[model samples]
Target: MLATRLTALLGIRHPIVQGGMSWASSNAELALAVSEAGGLGVIAAGPMYPDDLRAAIARVRAGTRQPFAVNVPLYNKRAAEFLDIVLETGVPVIIASQGGPKAHIGRFKEAGVTWIQVTANPLHARKAEDAGVDAVIAVGGEAGGHPGPDEVGTLVLVRATVNAVTVPVIGAGGIADGAGIAAMLALGASGAQLGTRFLLTPESGLHAAYKDLVLNAGIGDTAIVGRGRSPIRMVKNAFSAEYEAAANRGADDAELDALFARSSLRQAAKDGDVAQGKVEAGQSAGLIDKLEPAGELVERLAREAEAALSGAASCIR
Candidate 1:
């Protein structure tokens, strides 16, 4: 089995972790599938109600004896409630994002839960490590959803975070396959987390139209809306085009904010409004052409990563 510090800490056979994409992983199916395949599966608590989150956790527990995580964005209105549920449900791991971990990490540690903080840069990674996080997942600008406002590429950002922190680091953002995961490991990250790759899986909760659009996207097809504000990397569509036009014309923050508020990931993921909604996806969409079962994909990724690492080692001689 391919192993690393992350695999040992999380009790998984492989060091791969599925990114907890909202709407995409709001259900337990995808998380359960990945966990059963010996990867760390994360159920996103971002868009779920308290009861729904509990139910999702229960469903995953009932489906597999393997470990799984719940991603709780600390900036959400119900963040405290979500944390409560995570603690009460006895979840094995907590992948936290969008806020400082100093206040919350203590309790999770006390509960014997693994706390993996999501940081966007070296500074944040250092801060997370100082706050007692067991590990940190460094997200770069190429990631979908909120990929920080700095726009640093995954290679530079992940390597920077690895050098900045003493804890194990999981490199995220723009990773779509085994080669990418191997690259992260080579850069000193213990593992890699993939969002877009898992989002295109058959078990993802996105609308068919949303998946189709992402599946057809190219490497340069994604656009970043909101440069100074909280930014998101999504597939280029009408909504992004409109936003880009407004920004190009020097639209003020208020104007851009209003335009941004008009569309939502829920609109595209839930209603199939691919043309006018936030079809959130990463640059990795260009690398994925087909939808695979989450379980099978996890196994394939592990095998591919092993082969990639072995092949790269041959070059040393």
Candidate 2:
């Protein structure tokens, strides 16, 4: 039921993908578990330098033989260095986000690596398709971190991207279960990508406190902050509140720099400061219930999608 060009191209048994969360989602353990479980797992390259990325890639290799991907933030100053490391490591896939895919298409093609670009708008999706990338992942406003200002929902984005291009489209933002996956495929997406859902998995490197926050969150608990310049969607907390206020007041670079000088996202992830630390999570946080193994999570999602599809067919008949 999960069969699609995306899955076939990625060589994964399931069409589920784990969105790369920079500081929190790059751990090798979780990446390997997702890959071994039949989904394409992506390692976040945001917080790492070239050497660090190489080490992390090596760690993933140690855990599983299945193919996995590395995410490269195009806006990063060290993008070229990280890209070079990915090419050198023989990484099979790369997920490009935050910038134009056309900028890196040549490198990906030269390296013979599959490129999956994350886009929020249909226009960007078309651009990625024209650039000859393997696939496009359309993430809606419900996603964590930097969702675009247009902020289309998952259902809308998926359908729009599907209509706009012939390349495979992966649906993201607010997807957590088999029903969501089935719905995405029915809407013409080749696969579904989940972010907040996997944060609660046992293999995830998120702090226990952060994991607890995700488990207890409600539908409206999270809000978008830093909208105009550095828009970021995160769990509602003291830090987010302060950031939002600053952005609202049009805090200049100097003021904003002073405000964030001592604030460390990585430290917060490790220390689990729900109130003072920045927590990146999607609106789907409310839908996730318990912590389970990554493999079991993927299996359940695939089985659920199959059942949902079967049930839908029964209704049609």
Identify the runs in model 2 with alpha carbons over 4 angstroms from their true place: 243-264
- Cα lDDT tens digits for candidate 2, 1-317: 47888889888999999989876666687788899889988898988777778888998888888899999999989888888888999989999998987877897798799999999899998988888888999999998877878878888888988999999999999888999999999999999999888888888887898888878888788887655556667788888778769867888977776665545567567887878877778899889878988889999999999999999999984
- As a TM-score, model 1 comes out at 0.99
- lDDT, candidate 1, equals 0.94
Clashing pairs in model 2? none
**Best-matching candidate per TM-score:** 1
TM-score of each: 0.99, 0.93
Local accuracy of candidate 1 as per-residue lDDT tens digits, 85-145: 9999999999999999998888888999999999988999998888899999999888988
User: Root-mean-square deviation of each candidate, in angstroms?
Assistant: 0.7, 2.1
